[model samples]
Target: MAELYSRRSFLAGALTAGMLSTSAGYFFTRRNKIQLTLATGADPTGGRQLLVSMWNRLNPNVQIQVREVNSSTQDQFLKFNETHADIFNLDVIHIPRFAAEGKIVPIELENDISLVAPVRRVCERTGTDQLWAVPFNSDVGMMFRRVTDKRADAPVTLKSVLAASATGPVTFAGQLDTVGRQTDEAFVCNVLEHALAQDEAILDEGGVLSYGLGQWRDALAPLADAIRRKRVVAAAGEDDTARAFQRDSLRYMRNWPVRYLPLDRAERARPDTAEIRIDRLPLGILGGQSLAVAADSDYRDEAVRAIHFLTDNPAQKLLTSFGFAPTSVDAYIDADLQEALPHLSLVRYAVEGSRPRPIHANYAEFARRFADHTRRHLHDGEELTQQFITDIRSVLR
Candidate 1:
């Protein structure tokens, strides 16, 4: 459970960035020089120095620097708004807020704009018809398997998780503290999608409220029951889950693969422990990241170039090399890359079926309401589900 902050409070914090570094030089340059700063997630090999190197190689006159922001920071929007940065690696849901505030520039996604249709559709759903961002490093939740569990079988649904728990230990990142954070948010999104899949209308034609209470109730009941019954252990952290999996104490777990990258197979095995396996987040649901330009940037043209270079097939393939699932629709079909990453099909399904987080101007507020409600139900013994839906509706409204 990362510390929660109200949307208003986060906005207020934007007024407190006098400590941020000032622009190195005026935007005016002799040779079309554009100074761009990119705010990226905390992944060391992701959207970091590599993007700067690649962009510089493609556009020598452009100066782009990468700034690392702790993914857990609720005040990330504030930092984006206050920075001298011209570009950003923003989340899809958070983009609306910055766009609504006139702090982000909408991108002009030309030159085969369809490269990332799923990302584009998400912006359209948010009523941001103009491209508000570019695709940086993209990702999706992947299902992992312990190598020893050679049953040659893997569970791929809510029902499977519940059933697996009955036979052996299942661990999940269940701490309420991790709820509002992006990884945890993705976890919850999967839960919501699993619930919505049971209903035909998952999301309305307008892509607003989902209206299938009965199915949602049924879909989530097993998860709640498992948590309450001690058949499943809720880890306070992802590391805890990883540790348990390493000890052969965990038969199954759900989280992004980045957490597992730091561990080698030998360290993860207890003599007979087989290598862990990777697959996309369960079908019918997916979650990941997108890159957007700051509305306030004076360097939109140059920013667009940088965005393009980063998301194009060549760069996307480069990202794949770094363990990030490429967002490009075509990358999944690349024979060589697919061979290198055997789970490309699963990743493709997760990204294609993926839905962005609620893309409202007040997204943080909505996230808070949803997180609180989920925490109450999953942890506090709040057995009521429909009432929780009502509470969410009130806040969202």
Candidate 2:
């Protein structure tokens, strides 16, 4: 067994501002036949549906009619646009655009619980005085390597990891392709992470991107080098990388925190490697959904209360136990969770320092353009020149 965690402080109750004996959870009596529609994608973890079931049991009077929007993030997003659900579990990246468009209503958190910093930031609309949602469940990229033993708080850098790749045992892999997917969200995210790791100033306060010589190309050069050296491989997506790493040759791979549980369990079953040490990458890109209330729902107050229940401490603990990364810091440290998913510290650590992918209303189009531009460069030996950067800049607008 291996143990790991990343640098710095987790976001604690920043959404609540100051913590006192205050709770945002509201309960109502079963006076009326009230059923609120919750629109969320089908959850594999089943943690979310369980939360709904638990909430339903508690407040039988005000029941929830869940409308499982079964599909990918793209499909679910489009479904939300077509349907009028009271509560929406939306991708955190989409929250800003939703806020900007007035599609979702404002939400407040229960003051007693502290959300991870990066998760809290994703809930907030930048430069605005409001938060659109409470982080439902959080995801972030992390490097899982089979190590000999846990080290003593050592810093892992992009330079060091890139150097680790040789024509030998452990090769680096990531979700680098758009294989059989409607959108190239994973591909663009990996690219943005590489660039963001090198230069934090690439994007300005308003999320406008600007970069210079070597800042863009230098970061990706090593990846190309590794590909040429046969130390890195093209991946279909996260699932491909996850399955590829199990083959022993691809020991080091970047994947979601939620993946840690299944991977760890599978490794434990096989005992192929010594110990797997999970690391938070520099400029870790965050991913996940947050619970938001529909602006046009009739049951606005009830929906707000449900959001609190779904995201608060109790719900978070259950969700974490079920292999879903939680939003609350307290959920990460819960005694039972400490044993079941010991790597939660790593999740908390990664998310503390993680950041959301580029936020744009036309993010899907940007992803498409980015994939078309970078695929050849990454998969083949083609170079990404200044023209590549210019094309990206044009699409960003």
Candidate 3:
């Protein structure tokens, strides 16, 4: 009877081991086949699709699904919270707020130091050494003028820009003509770029608001005079300005490098018609999206791998071909890229010196208040009173 009991126990132990081996095999198989979800703003040129296809060819086991969200930062943030996608792209300015809320997961990139210095600098949380996102693509404010004009050495200063405008058609999207709140932020960006170029500090060392109403008014006065004299065509936004420039209605404009892609293609086709020349802005505003992983994502490892794949050298080169400026320094220096992007050197210079927007948890509120008051001052002839300064201070608080 004892022998029979010992044999039964041995058989039971063998059955348990068999079951464990089958479970392990199933787990490993599931781990090898991961599906990742990515949320990003609409890309009309199918660039995002092409990028995903390239990624899939390199990584055959992982599949990526893309979802299109609203272009606004606030809307994207809302979607991030609601969907909890494995990965999401956000504007650099939004990094601080998201980090403060603990919504994003910090990642350790192997080549973090190799990215463009200014672009890499803004990925960290303010007043701390923690990094929250990876730089994907970047844009800066640049001057676009007709190549044939050759007037005033490309307007190195705001004064020079105004002086050149006096000679020919110069238009900017500096108007506060919109009834809705849509154009307010663009107006503020234009103002900040001009102010920074003149060495005016918008925030002090301690990150408190420092630029006074008087200083801002002084910086904007020249543009105001041009608008009044009909020397500057004040459009509503960059799209309007680009369209006007395309139709040969304007000789000079301030726009992003992405806007130059179509113009470049057109010039290539014509080869004899007017071509556009781009140069560094007096001060360029840093603009671009950063990739962040979700803290609660089920596929964190896969998501990180995807981020690395997208930011790798080859992927960055592809991004430039799609009219997006890559953050990788190598991509900027590639000879083929320089030939394709005639303004590559100027872009590199701008990226190196570009000024980051204000970093604060309540930055959205601050921007809204600043834009509202500035627009009112520009359009309604309202005074930049002490009360206005006080209101801005309250919003920052």
The best candidate by lDDT is 2
Residue lDDT tens for model 1, 272-326: 5655566554433334456777666777777776676566665565566555666
What does candidate 3's lDDT look like per residue over 1-397, in tens digits? Answer: 2343344345334433433343221122234677778878777655556767656655557788887776554344566667758888887867877888988888877553368877877887555665688887888878776655445434455557676677765554333233344555566667676656554576332334564777767766766566666676666667666776666545567777777766655653543445667778756777888889988789887788788767666666667766677788987887766765667888888878777777776777777777777667666667677777887788666
Q: What Cα-based lDDT does every candidate model obtain?
A: 0.57, 0.69, 0.67
All candidates: TM-score: 0.79, 0.83, 0.83
After the best TM-score superposition of candidate 3, give how far the Cα of residue 74 lies from its true spot, in angstroms: 5.4
How many pairs of residues collide in each model? 13, 1, 0
Worst 10 residues of 1 by lDDT: 15-24
| CA RMSD of all predictions | 9.9, 5.8, 15.0
Error of 3 at 86 (Å): 1.1
TM-score of 2: 0.83
